[model samples]
Target: MDADTLRAILDAQAMQQQKAFDAQAMQRQMRHQKTLDAVMERMERMFSAMGATPAGAPASTAEFVTNSLSTRLPEFTYDPDSGCRFDVWYNRYEDIIANDGSTLDDAAKARLIVSKLDAATYARFTNHILPKKTFDVSLDETVKILKELFGHNTSVFARRYAYLRTQRNDETIRDYTGLVNRHREMAEFNDVTPEQMKCLVWICGLANPEDADIRVRDLRKMENNPQTTLKELSAEIQQFVDTRCQALRKPAIINTVWYVSQRRPHWAKDCDFANKTCHDCKRVGHKKGYCKNFTSKKKPIPKQKRRSANNVVTARPKLLPPLVSLKSANNTEINVRGHFNCNFNIDGHEGRGNCHEADTTSLLGLDWIAQDEPLFRRLTKGAICNVSASKLNTLRTSLTKQLQKQFVTVFAPGLGRCVKSKAHLALKPDAKPVFGKARPVPYAALPRISQEIDRLVAADVLSPIDHSDWAAPIVVVQKISPTLRRLLYWTERRTQATPAPTSNA
Candidate 1:
């Protein structure tokens, strides 16, 4: 071969190799474009199914394809535990199909639903429908079957009744009415009007029925008027409530004084001043100048008796003995038989003796003795001594004065007084009888205990029973000193019963 021929042949072979490589690259590009076209078509269908459109107008097929590929379907997965509501799943699947622009036939939709079902739901669907050779059912038919299997239709009636009976105390009228309407919708009652529903809800939801009849009448009138809205009716009801609250807040005028006066006479009006005495003549129904003794001068006007600093009769000062002895030898012992003792320490001086022998100087220093000298003398006089007529007269005057003063009337047991407890003790259902061994009373204290028991029984503080299932032993305890005894009803034994286990336990 020649050099020129060899060079031309080499060029032709290189060109042919390059042409073959170009043809293979063009084929690969065409394949890639076909794959991309298929992908774009699928994405466009998905975006259409999802109800989404491209953001802007595409100038070319490539741009349109690119935009379509960018669109995405919402991500959702079936969950059996989510709920058994077929409507919810159906709606979601419907959106998915629409977004994917899927031309799913009834059978295809059924298959898609089966694929989306969780294991349990899938098994259930197949077992229930496939057995009847109903595999190729429509979406609606599948939903119907599923609904019949899991639908809460049975509970709807119960819920409706419960809803109707519900009252609205804490919630607003509008909120309560809204709940009622929602429940009514769920109940799907036939031949019910909006007016009827509103009236039923109003009547049922009213917390206060003080004027229920009147309210019902008003509601009926409103129901008849087509122009009256639920809002207007609610406003009226709210106004009524406001007015009622305001009326209740007003202070009630109670004539307590008038009522008491009606029950009893006025104290001032009932008081009688006619028996008041005059200080001048010591006589009733007249003043000092108008006194009969002073006006008539029937007898020598008795001189007004004067009292000393000790409130003792100064007119008879010379008649009484000296209050204190000047010499120790003159302190004679005077024995008096009486319960009154004169053991008083006054002004660093001690008076220690019977009431009759009490030092008059010490008694005069004592304010109590000075104010009640007549009573003191009467109480201190020896039991065997003959009381003089004048002293007896003084005692009578003191007694009469005390009797004339206002005093509270005390009704004792003997006077037919009775007392009752406000509330009686209520024992629990599970209460157990408390049993305790009786404590032995001390031999020396037995008489005292018996006397105390007798006193309590007589006073109705304690009652004797022949037998009792619940018994708390009596315990004697010393109080103040060993000489004083108190009978105690030991309640520890009664309260120590084994407590029943609680619910939490």
Candidate 2:
């Protein structure tokens, strides 16, 4: 009983101690697993709310991750008077934190919220809660303090209700409804259903009595029909308003030209001047009886005779050359010198004889003797007046060479005479000269203007002056070509003057 019993007892005690240790370790493992599961569930909920895939799924591609991270979060700076809503801020903050798919601790989130607070709010927190180490405060404690300090005030609800009571004429139906809804939320009034309250507010808020009555009738119809929603009613009301506005608009006028001749036969008699002609004066639009130049009386003058030696009459002025006539049945004959190859058909008739140049008088029925003298002389100038194509080509070549030598001086694209002429402004006896203010050149056109100025200077088209008695501002006009701008010297102010006396007094 001495050695064996003692050793057995020690071994049993040791085994019991080991079992207790194992049980404690197993309990700890279970607790750790529960904590891990809870965290995973929270993460899943946050990801779902943010429309992001769960962590267990494959990681998003690089582009997807980049787009998600690059999105800007809505910034909210706290206002003391309108104090930020805790729930709204928390939701936004949580989403922004989740954008990077990383977890943030409560302390870090609290610090971020404090950082966004306005100076007054931050001061209030520091003064009321933690003056020293304010950021060290927990998120839950900060949130609670903020809610108590800046949460909905009873006075705000009263003000909202007062605003709803007073309706404005210019306010739209949508805005009026929104205002009512906002107040209703703050007041937390549960006396009537939301839809009923909205309808009542809408009817009351309408400035026009007729519009209110119509809306009330529509609401009654909606009440009878359970499926119709308030949103649909609002849309219908907006549509009616738009249609009424269109109806109130003035209609466009259309002008049409009507033919009176087709409408009535009497129209021709009314517009008789159109076809009437004057017979006495040999003109249009009047009869012979109305001719102003016609005379009823006639007078005669005496004639003188020619006499001898010193008073002898000279020969009469030379008469014009007689027109030559040719007979043809099917074709017209044109004779230039001895050539008669220029015969052409005329009124389905043909000629049978060869005509000389002297035999043919009129050219295409135009009588050179009776026609303009200068034109006739030009038509009959040189002996070889009708030159061949080869001779004409030689003349053209010589003329082109001469033109090329003087092209720049003759064909400059500007006011050619204006360049040599100095502008003279006529002024009234008492009028004073006006010096115009110089306009600034635009930044985009500076380079182009500089280049144009340089070109003008080089061509001696423009020159700089040290001073002048009169100065006019330059106006730059843009052209179709981007490189070119038309610069004009505005002289309206300088040239315009008072009217002079119409007649010498």
Each prediction's RMSD over C-alphas, in Å, is 37.4, 37.3
Which lDDT values do the candidates have, in the order given?
Answer: 0.58, 0.59
lDDT of 2 at 298: 54
Question: How well does each candidate superpose onto the true structure, as a TM-score?
Answer: 0.23, 0.23
CA deviation > 4 Å runs, candidate 2:
1-75, 80-88, 91-102, 153-166, 190-505
Give the 10-residue window scoring lowest on summed lDDT in candidate 1.
Answer: 406-415
lDDT of candidate model 1 versus the reference? 0.58
Best by TM-score: 2
The residue ranges of model 1 lying beyond 4 angstroms of the native Cα positions read 1-84, 98-101, 155-157, 166-185, 189-505
Candidate 2 root-mean-square deviation in Å: 37.3
lDDT of 2 by residue, 1-505 (tens): 7999999999999999999999999999999999999999999998786676454333344335434533544444444344355545656566665545344456655666676665445655676774457666787888888766656543432433444575656679998787677556654565445764565566556657667756555556555653445686678788877888899999899888775544345554575654567766677765457566756565533344323332455533333333444455667754344423233444443333333354544445333222455545665665485556877888998998777544544544543433223455356787665667878989998997788888787655788889876666778887777555566544445333533323362
Q: Candidate 1 lDDT, tens digit per residue, 346-432?
A: 444455543433332423434445445565576577556654576887899887766543221231122222232233455677878
Clash count list over all predictions: 7, 6
